[model samples]
Target: MSDIDRSPKAPDLYVHYCEHQGCDNWGSWGKSPSAAVATRWWCFEHFPHKSFDRNRR
Candidate 1:
């Protein structure tokens, strides 16, 4: 077998999102099942609900 074939397979990339509404940010959010379809996704400006909420408040 060639070295190319011996190389480890790349990790499967999944669609991740924030658990907020009306958000479609697909990326790492330090959450599990990161690739699963999420209820919502928060953009950089709308991440970390606690902070986002406080800012909105």
Candidate 2:
């Protein structure tokens, strides 16, 4: 085993695109367990409007 901190890190450089139908933004928000959100991903622009309902309240 190796000692490493693999926790989530901030997105400084371009990682990936949002999983929205036709979005072209970088995916800043996403699920950890992979079974929470339907699309499982959304950019900082669309997450609040789409995944909030399922995640919060």
- Per-model root-mean-square deviation over C-alphas: 7.2, 8.1
Which residues of candidate 1, in runs, are more than 4 Å off? 6-9, 27-42, 49-57
lDDT, candidate 2, 1-57, per-residue tens: 457867587768747678878998888786553455354667877776644566555
Q: What's the number of clashes in each of the models? A: 0, 0
Q: lDDT tens digits, residues 1-57, model 1?
A: 676676468788777675567666764544323356434444566567575456544
Q: What does the lDDT read for residue 56 in candidate 1? A: 44
True-structure Cα RMSD, model 2 = 8.1
Residue 39 of model 2: what lDDT? 45
Q: All candidates' lDDT scores?
A: 0.56, 0.69
Worst 10 residues of 1 by lDDT: 31-40
Best by TM-score: 2
